[model samples]
Target: MLSTSGTIIGIDSSTGACSIAVCRGGTMLAHFHEDMTRGQSERLAPMAEAGLAAAGLGFPDLDAIAVTRGPGSFTGLRIGMAFAKGLGQALGIPVFGVTGFDAVARAVFATEAAAGHGIAVILESRRADLFLQIYTTGGAPDGPPVALPPEDIAARLCQEGAAPLLLAGDAADKVLAVLDQASAAMLRSSLITAPDAREVALIGLEMAGDGDIPPALQPLYLRAPDVTAPRAG
Candidate 1:
């Protein structure tokens, strides 16, 4: 029984950046974002508290919590999920999970930026491969998200034919670098390089308005974490 009219705080620590936004009735009341490759665990809670303070609210004032579910840094995703769920449980409210792709795509479509162009979301994976997804001009996903190297992503875009395309996400530059001049000619860069918690909040509000129960929160891992095993001492 979620309601958009109630206060909501959206959290996103799924990328190099971590952000939180407080919104009421679909309008943002406060937002705080910081760019960092690590330390999300330390910064997220304080940022969330700051957002609530700026909005003149407290934990008890929040009606629900919204958080990005990932396709991002493994540790960052876990930190965000745990924070949102813990807060929700303590407050006796629901926690909604939104994918990083959906958060960015919804923001893009809202601005009408992809009106006549295809969209390729190029999220950084911090590895040789990246999390990628394509979308039609109409804002529908062209296909499922996949983990691919920059070269393969460029090849896939080329194979889609020369419809003007918009390249988004934090890794757009990485993908753009590998595209040849001809392919590059048809592509445009979106201003949204990272998923913002403000957008996460709006999307969450929409989810609440839809009147369906929110799915469980889980990290959207596109690839296994890159870890090295220690040799026996």
Candidate 2:
């Protein structure tokens, strides 16, 4: 739970998806999310306002703001960070950045038991690559995230020597085909997709309470943005 009595807001415009949530003392009071491919800049502010309204609060009542740092769409991360910064500054509150994977992991770990193979979160990164991370069932890291080709990820999973693996996040479907063939006998994977805004709020609350907020709250771009300048002539 947050150490203070004020409200906290969490934003995640880190993929094609967008979400905003408000919480009081680690309990989510309201949230909004959309799986749209565009229009985040226009949608985010209203969503934030709606969340605050649902919580019977306003921007001035907030104590902190949280946002997904990334390993996601470049444009989406920028938009979310900019919004969080603006709102935090205007409200005189702190802004914290949480990774998309960490948010999802927190969400999953809250409801599930910690006795399975592990949790694998895969979010689409626009190209053929994916943003992938492995976490123990207890929300501890098995390894850091890596951007890997679908086949390579499947191959590695086949070699992991684990069973009953749980898979979640936006890109689970795309990875399923590859994983099915690669690890058919050795591993089992489930596709469960949903972003729990409440879970995000809870995690943000804990971070705020702990005073572990980042200095800048930038996006966690795991790989370089897809677009790069052309070579000098």
Candidate 3:
């Protein structure tokens, strides 16, 4: 008989999407999601509580807490990390970090294959740039994520070889405009706007089950914060 590994909570408050999930081993038991334009601090914890309740568990019953570590909205990232850290510390359980991009990529790949080309997941950064990454159909990273000016991303896509690409994430609509023009004649595209917390939870549980927990869980901030104070003239 397989021994139970207890429950895990996956929290993702990245982009405009916020979600919580409960899982055991690699199976997701319950999930909650919301499209919050503001107030993640207010919603995340309650959502987590609800998800745990739905799974018939509580914070004390969780074996681990997993969260999306950035390359996303700074406020959202901080809220998620803080909540996970506090919960884990209180319960004396381990807390792990997964990338926001990777979480969305996993959800997309779980649904389809990148048979002809590659996949790109884009998340809107409140700046003039977009957060983007390319991945193989099997969820392997093709390259590091970059915060690029919208036009530059379009140019790059046009230059890449003709392969059917799948696009998804919080910034799907904005990214689609450029991608559509770039790959207008050759590439095919599909969009999934939100990342699934259930998928994130399952992936996190799998990693934890494999003893792949890293000591430091940090968010993937691709660029400096937009609010830099100008030097005095």
Model 3 TM-score is 0.87
Residue 51, model 1: lDDT of 90
Estimate the TM-score of every prediction. 0.93, 0.87, 0.87
C-alpha displacement of 110 in model 3, angstroms? Answer: 1.2
lDDT of 2: 0.75
Task: Identify the runs in model 3 with alpha carbons over 4 angstroms from their true place.
Answer: 1-5, 113-116, 160-162, 179-182, 228-233
C-alpha root-mean-square deviation, candidate 1: 1.6
lDDT of 3 by residue, 14-49 (tens): 778788889887677898888886899999888988
Clashing pairs in 2: 69-220
Writing each residue's lDDT as its tens digit, candidate 1 over 74-118 gives: 889999999999998999888889889988887777777778887
- lDDT of all the models against the reference? 0.87, 0.75, 0.76
Tell me, by lDDT, which candidate is best: 1
